[model samples]
Target chain A: MHYWRDGILALPTTSHYLQLVILWSIPINFLTKSYEFMLSAKKIIKCLDDHWPVLETLVGRSTLGSFSFQDVQALIQRHSPGFSSEQVFREAQRLLHHEVLIPLAKSSQLELNRAVLEFIQFLTQEHQLGTVGDIQSRIEDLDRLRGKLKAAADTKDVSEMRRFIRLMDERVREVVKHFRKNESAIMHLVEKAKADDTKLSLAKRYSAVMEAFDEYIEPVLQMIDINAPFQHSMQALEHQLSELILNIEQTGFLQSEKEPLVQLRTRLLDMNQIGREALIRSTDVLMPLREELRKNTLISRNASALLAHLRKKGLEPTLEQLVPKFSSDHQKFSLGSANQITSYMAELVDFQDEAYQMPEQVDPGDNANIRVPDLAEVLKSARVQKANTDLSKWLAKSYPQLPVDELLFLYQELSRAPTLKLQHLEQYSTLEVNGYRLTLHPFVPTATSGT
Target chain B: MQIELEQLTQLAEIHKKLSTGYHVSEQDFALWQELDTNEEAYSALFTALGNQLKRDSRGYFHFDVDDATVNMGKISRLFALTTYALVEFFADQGQDPLRALFEVEISHEILASILQQQYHLFEQLEVFSATDLKREVMNRMLRYGFAKAQGEHFKLLSPVYRYLDALMAVDQLAEFPGESSTSSFTSNQEQADV
Candidate 1:
């Protein structure tokens, strides 16, 4: 049978000989169709293996929309770089023919087959968080199947009981599968959110985490709660399956049915055990992150709000009363200590005064020969100068014996002379007089005050 | 009240640190363990010394005071502004502000940017530049047991919740003006003014 399937699958599309043989043999119809399905499945597995890079890229980018055939062809060419346009086109057609990539509705755009996409995501550990309703409905289906199984068992309808057992087994496996997938998906979300290079904004980064908590973790937690309907229903289903198994064990008439009953019972119990463990592990991984995000949001919000207040009301007023205070006795810059105080007190206590020392009088004869300049004589010298004459320069040249202060004193008196008109210069003039370089606003006579 | 002399070996050191407004946290090994082990004894000892010893559940010990000195008040205000500015700055960059504030070792470059961006706010605290900020706020934070320096970088200690508490208090005050907000501190913390 395998060789016949391979021979037909390997035949070229235009081979009329095989078609004629298949048409002539009516009994081989079902066999041929099943072979074709197996062939198609094998082709898809091979296509996925050969072009996984392209499919992975498509899965990542096409989270929402379908990709055009040309886009797939381009991805093929990009994946191999050396492939010709014809080769890329052939690869794309093979992907579609094998049903590895399927058309979306009647549109020409193609998408990864839903089943294959999920399989690949499972392999990659990049699962979308399934809703609580998904698992809840499965569990509800299991409950309904248990009732049917019990009825079939009561009547000793072995075929009906077997059918319900198969259905219940599938449902139990599905619930366990959902639990594991959702748990892994949440783990993925946390890792992506915590990754340092995630360029998403904080809100965007944590949105998936928040959604997982609200949509998956929170509702699932309620469902699997110890006293919740989920737990009770699971327990009821376990009890029913076990009762059926017990009934089969007691009745030797249905000895052939005992194995399937035992298998289904074990599966139901395993599902419950695995589901609880998965939820616990997921919650453990996620609880701290949820708490950290909550605290982070609170801190950032309060900080920003307080900052705005501080900006508007000013810092001192906004925070003055709120700031935690401490004792002020440990002054960092205090200059006085007990030792200094004691020293001051000691100095005050040792009260004594030395006898007043009178200094010896200096000789008076050194100043007697150098006569002091009379202000009247300097005034007479100034009145004879040209208009706008610099009083400082003239004084320095005429009375080089006088000290700078004494010269300045004469200049002050001459400027105030009632008999001579003089003008003060706004601009300064420098003079080397009496060992001093003085930059002063020299008193130059006004143009009108010239003699 | 009774006293246990043998159990209070870190009394003098604890008194010195707490008296100076330095929070004794887990980082202060022997002293923190001393306080943790014999809290009642230490509390009575400090109470007899005329100090209100505060044990914040957030993990630290401090000497609670009704009012701060003028200088300490100024320093505390600077701390408040710097912390708020850091939060805003980290949030703007999409980093978790609380984690960044506590976990990350803030470099001088980050400090400089925060100071530059919040120039108007820091000016009120007399923090004119990054160096001034390090000296007036960050370094002073070290002395007050609010942060620890790691070479050239620094990370805030848990007692920084004092400012975080103050941050919330400012909001509460705005919402409800008549009631005083003492969310974190053990004492009233509201003594009107320095």
Candidate 2:
């Protein structure tokens, strides 16, 4: 075994170069000079192939280039059979610490290996790489080698294990160094991609905010009455002042209470200034197009004054009185009937027509001593009698030339008496004067007992 | 009279067919069979009964059995068949009766059948009422299809063509055979016993 080991060690370093030549050669017959070259290449290739573990360690460190612990273990398992994944993994770990594979720091190698495995897993799962047979085969070969390294370490083959560990240490260092360089570049690219993604998302958010403002806010602003801005501002100010007052009251600080009140007054003054500015702006905007409306405002002020007077007095003014004292053209108003003065009066008084109610007769006895004549009795007593009317008709027909007012005065004077009958007033139905008939209805006071 | 009875019996048969999976009573079947044999008598009786189904100014048929007018039961029976046949025919033409029923004034029974046939409307049936049916019909007439209920009123979804078409068809059927010659018809009569 020691002689075989020495022979294996003495094998030409050029053996790998010869193997490379054989690997590069095309198929050829044994009779050709090319066949002699091929034959020499084949012997070297066989020697290297037979002692692949030794060649792999030497070449991996000097020429084949370094590999990760995983890759070194994979190579080990590939060249030597009967190695478990657990053994390969353990040996690979020991090699990584010995610095035989590559010159990487142990921590850096471990981190890079973990990252690479994670990346491989992501690629396999996310990109659906399991369907590819080549990738699967490579993964299996690497896993098997990892197992063999683990097994060698477990069996206490200290020299073989140390050699294996040193080989992996060198490979791991190279792999980690290579990965570190590439990782920085990849990191820079990823950072740039993330920045671009952030910019896109920010732009989308800005557009969405503008769209929401346009769809929801712009229409709402348009629908609001122009006068409402001032009203809303005033209301908000009032609410703020009220809240401030409440807060001050709750704090029970006398100085603070005064402070809020002063602040409120200042705020009100500021609001007044703002209102003036707004008013100026509105006047500037409206004056060019609304001269008629401006004129109408003066008339509306007068009408408002009149309405206020009526409301203060608690009196319902008639439509005649309430009508604005303006020309018909100036009075081009559109107030509803429900708002009219007459309608207001009718509602206020609750008036009903007396014609619909039952009539009540007055008794003369009730007012006999008061000297107040009965209005109803006076209307009833002035009736013309048909029998006395014949003489008055004859006199009216016979005395067409007499002055009516004079004849009626004479008739009234003749009919005057201390005791005048209610029926005697009907006798002077017609009195003729200046060819005009005058019908005199004389008043007679009815007799009443002295109270 | 026999023809009127036969039509009523046929309606009853259709109702029975829908409700209890039966066709007609023994008496109704015998009357139908007898009426089926005499086409001239049946036609004459149908013409007379059709004349009585004519609407007055109020747009309602004045079916009075005492006034030699169409019996209310006969008119109702005829109306039921015509409505059912219409629903079936519209359905066959790829028009969903539930949609059409919602488009016109129709009773809950018809709507229930429509719901039974079309499961999509089963959930909506619980919310509908008799008043809703009347308003829905008028809305379809005035507007066309189903309208959103506004307090007591309903607005139509489409034009009033469906309502006009249904009314016209019913009116034409009421004025059947020789009754078409008459321009005016009596209305506002009491409904007869079912």
Candidate 3:
């Protein structure tokens, strides 16, 4: 009896050592054979622990709680070496029968949880983020990176591709985090920008206006020299200023009296003054200066007719030669340069003759009878004359049906007597002879009445 | 089709009387119905008769007959002439002595009665229906040696008045038959006949 009691005591010690051996062997087997398998098993166990309730809820039963033990055993076995698929299956059956393994429905939930946990771990470890705060901070870091990427894209800088790739990775992590929490708001923001046609158009217009101003107007303004810095800037912005003025006029943005454009105009005029000064300063020093002088002489002419008319009207008649003073004060002329002035006047007369020379008058007698050609013919001739010879030939070939006469008349009216009134055509009434009225052509009637 | 035509004729007569600003009587409508079977014929007769009966330019009938400006007396005279001319034209065309003479003579009596009843009703009224009537009357008028309707209105051939006067004289002679009452009536009747 004493011996049996001692053996029992020794058996407990051996059992303890055997359990320790199994525990030690497990880790060694995992480390030596399939570290990845061991990691997967731990991951699955952690997933189950985290999502136990979720799995149960998805399974739609409380039965999954009893299966938790079986889940742990299967996961442990799954990590062990020398375990056949049959052995794993038998273990799963035992747990399932005992309600230790969750239902198939709960298993699916567990698998999804495992995937999410893996993704989360990947994101945290790979991107160097530990929490939501870390994700937020990373996103802030990405802003500058994203701007650089955009600039690189704009400049087509191939050297920045690696930096862009790093940025893309970080951006993916940030986007995933954002999607998890504020998916709806982010979606709405994207959709709103996409759907709003007006906003899109406005954005385009704003960009286009900016580009146009930069290209066309900026260079012109920069070339001009101005004393005032503010004026120089304004001169540079002339094109934009003009555009603003046009917009104000066309849209009546100011005329509604809500937003007055006078302030804008005043600003523009100030700008113009600066621009003019700058232009003057920037003008080439070697450029020739122009000097013009004029002298006034009053002479009495045949005004007796006008004096008589004024006397008849009981009014005093006074004649005065009023020569307005020059508005610009750049220079002035003094008296006593009569000889030089006379020579200048003579030159001025010669210049005037050259500049204001009249064309020789056509002799009407040579063309007078002119057979009083058909108005239609006259109009056709006018059209032909107005059209370039090449264009006229092309038009004649292309539009044979066009009323040449009418076109000529239109051309003549447009060129010679633009202000001709329709009332001129109404002067002739239908002529009655022997109780019969004749319908004369419009031109004929006008011509006859005038005659 | 016949029923529609009859309805149309009635409507036209109603339109005509309404156009004249006159309250048509049942007897007058019956007389108008008896006068012509054809709707087009009736319109012509009615239009012509209206022109004859309403002498003043103030009423709807004067407006209908004289689209342009006309003095009341001239309208009255034109109305008289129109009625007489229509009756004569129809009589000559139909060659129905009784109906023709009857139409002519009745138009004169109708005028006299209408004038006696109220002359002021035929003055200063505008004719809004001339364009429509002119379009309607031209095709038929073309057959009768009458001038085609012109300028949104109809103008009677000048010779029509003479034909109407002759018809009226014949009718008056037939109706009076030796009643030599050389009064204003006889002279007026004679003028109408002439």
Give model 2's share of reference contacts: 0.00
Candidate 1 structure quality by residue, lDDT tens digits, A284-307: 546645655333456665665565
- Give the best candidate by TM-score: 1
What is residue A208's positional error in candidate 3, in angstroms? 50
CAPRI-style class, candidate 3: incorrect
Error at A143, model 3, angstroms = 2.6
TM-score of each: 0.41, 0.13, 0.14
Q: TM-score of B chain for each model?
A: 0.86, 0.21, 0.23
Tens-digit lDDT string for candidate 3 (A1-451): 0011121233334333443333334434332334243334454445546444433332222212223444444554645445676766664454333222334464432222223322332221211111233233444454455456546645646457345544544343333332222222111122122122232343341332232233322443443335544344434334433554575478764343213223333433533443343223212100111100111011000111122112122221111111101101111122323333554676677674336768999875523343434545544653444432222233333333435543344334533432221122333434333233433322221222222
Candidate 2, residue B63: lDDT: 19
Look at candidate 1 and tell me the lDDT of residue A437. 87
Question: Where does candidate 2 stray beyond 4 Å?
Answer: A1-402, A411-433, A436-451, B1-89, B92-108, B113-194
List iRMS (one decimal) for every candidate. 21.3, 43.5, 54.6
How does chain A of every candidate compare to the true chain A by TM-score? 0.55, 0.13, 0.18
Q: Which tens-of-lDDT digit does each residue in B1-194 have in candidate 3? A: 12344445465545544343332222244633433334354445444433223221211111122222223223333343233323323322333423433233323333333232112222212222333223333333332223334444344443233233333332221121111111112222222231
Q: What proportion of true contacts does candidate 1 retain? A: 0.43
Best by DockQ: 1
Q: After superposition, how far is residue A86 of candidate 3 from its true place, in Å?
A: 7.4
In the order shown, the candidates' Cα RMSDs to the true structure are 29.1, 42.2, 51.2
